[model samples]
Target: MNRHLLYAALDAAERGWAVLPLRPGDKRPALHGEDVCPGIGDCAGGHRKWEERATIDPDRIHRAWGDLPFNVGIATGPSGLVVVDLDMPKRKSSTDTPNGVTTFTALCERAGQAVPATRTVRTASGGVHLYFTAPSGVRLCNTAGRLGKRIDTRAWGGYIVAPGSLTPMGAYAVVNDLPPAPLPEWLSARLTARQASRALMTAPSAVRASRYAAAGLNAETASVRHAPEGERNATLLRAARALGRFIAWGDLPREQVEEALQWAGEQAGLSPRSCEATIRSGLNWSIARNGQRRVA
Candidate 1:
């Protein structure tokens, strides 16, 4: 009995949150220790961890929504909470200001104290999550630019999307009433200085992985993460101008090769509002408008 995912996983396990199931309209994991993927190329690595069968147990979420119309998720560190997603960008500039509502209103003016209006949700592309709580020991990891440019931060193995869920791109509602915010000791020292500047940019430096393997671009980054779609934006502008000719030969780090060519142009689908302006205009048309034709 789905009943809106069995009363939304028993109202997110009566607000202690943990839930799980997902896979109605879709967000993967509709159970399968035995079988249930009647599609999606029959799962496998396509996705199925269901975060080790997440649960707050209202009778195991009523036998996991009695196997019907699923989608609910919400696990976030055994429910200690910590979401803050905020996505929203499809190309701003109607006078800007919407980087997830101006980075949660500049972290409530630098955590002089504010975040108390939580349990927000909304997302279905327009983006927004909010929630909070986990800050005790502080380890809040899972990040993709934690506080800017389409911000993200989902703590400890993460999981969300559960406000009465539904998806084929729509329906995650809760939109804030309040309850869940707490992590702000100056936003936990600005997320521990953004986790030490992302561990000093992924701790590599054997001369930046030998100049990022001399930008040979391993088969054009596996064809820019499987390009196709009528040559996915000219194969992601030819792999961001061969990662800007390995960052104009100083060998790399134009913000980590434009965050790995915008995560390979979002695994070749692009459209996250022009994936960071198509990798910053194909990395300034190959390092500043064809830097003297990158010297033969």
Candidate 2:
């Protein structure tokens, strides 16, 4: 690896945000060793391996740059960084290279929208890491997982592709400075409207599961109860719709659910319509039983 390039990347990263360097073998560099510094490490000396060497002063960087835009890190090579969307279905064996690359590209495109400044760095695994400068205060969640399952990206020990992490590969550093398009103002508004509609229509359905559970009915019993005609059909339809909505928007934080619903409503150009009260009630009950708070 090019030590000079690594130093330069660390220096550039220090100019904006703090960086945590990962040695070739270390996994949890931050948690391990005696060294509490962000940049330097002593992995070669086992006894003194974790001794803190030095740390980049965030205050000093801020004073020098006057409010830098992002935080970043550098990896020795492409293998150092890995990309996983955690949205894709997992395979029983072998890696899904095509699908993985597609998802990675999509994430890069999305990041490009928020931070116009982006650079692509190659990984040792022959994959690419898309680097971008994240805007202030925007943090990413659920990043270390497969496109659908729990894919741990930390195994590679490179930069994360989320909003807060910087994109760096091997000796090369990707810098994104161009401004991307802003999200539409009406998006959140539309989601709010849809949420309101769903709230009203699904009110009754929300409590259905709770009602069954209250009556000492297990899942099997509840299924039998809904086997009848008329009300049963409506109940099934409501359940399906509610589940679909959840699947479509469940990844968003609960706080953002209302806004997302409103946005969906606007994009579809449809008036918000609530699902049946039975469905809402059943969903509520299910959520409660699962020890989860309902977002919509």
Candidate 3:
């Protein structure tokens, strides 16, 4: 692997927040297990290769940035970062064409409008990474929770995009000599608020405790009954956001629910088959555990 590309990815992630690099060796605190690339190429080689399996330590990335506010990173190749925008659209298949490209294009267009100097385009992997020169006088947040915790853009090593992994065509970018995108004050505030909301949702311990209290159940019982439901509900809401909807769960139509669930599954890195099972299980669990109970 070209260390330059790796550093480039790292630098990109650093623009958004502080990042920890996970490579083949060198273990200060090691992440658990070998990363499973899934349908992407093998990232185990430490260099870019075919598009079947790319691997990075998700646990480590999560852990490293868990408490920090709003950190994001790249997961595959020397130049990719994991971008978690609640605004990102959800789809059924990771390899689904047009959808990925369309989303990428849309994001780039928005970014261009937001910061004209930061022009971006699509990558072959169907994933888009927006690039910009380091802006002067702007100190980007390096922690994980600053940008509404809902959006994460960090460069850890496990995520795989196209051409580099699953897509045969590979990733492509629209290059322009553009200045770094300026972070708008209003946008930054909104993102920060969103991150705060995300923190509440992902805070497992706090959520479990709250559920137990609300359901009048003990911790152990709540662990099984309430906790998973809470998680499932949050996941579903995330799905809805990815699908670009603003309605509450009860307000969503069945078809929309199905589409959102599929998109959520893709974000979770689940296969199409797994996504189906997950959606079914989540819905069933919700009904069984909270019959006639409304989810706020």
lDDT of predicted model 3: 0.35
On the 0 to 100 scale, the lDDT of residue 139 in model 2 is: 24
Please give the distance, in angstroms, between residue 179's alpha carbon in candidate 2 and its true position after superposition.
Answer: 10
lDDT of 2: 0.33
Ranking by lDDT: 1, 3, 2
Candidate 2 TM-score to native = 0.32
C-alpha RMSD (angstroms) for model 2: 16.6
Q: Which structure among the candidates has the greatest TM-score?
A: 3
- Name the weakest run of 10 consecutive residues (lDDT summed) in model 3: 157-166
- Please give the distance, in angstroms, between residue 84's alpha carbon in candidate 2 and its true position after superposition: 8.8
In angstroms, the error of model 3 at 20 is 10
Q: Candidate 2 lDDT, tens digit per residue, 181-249?
A: 222223223323433543343222332233422232122224423343224434333443343333233
Query: Candidate 1 — what's its lDDT?
Result: 0.67
For every model shown, what is its TM-score relative to the native structure? 0.32, 0.32, 0.36
Per lDDT, the best of the predicted structures is: 1
- Superior by lDDT: candidate 1 or candidate 2: 1
lDDT of 1 by residue, 178-274 (tens): 8887876776688777566544543434375563443354445557768655577788777777667666655665776665555555545443345
Residue 245, candidate 3: Cα error in Å is 22
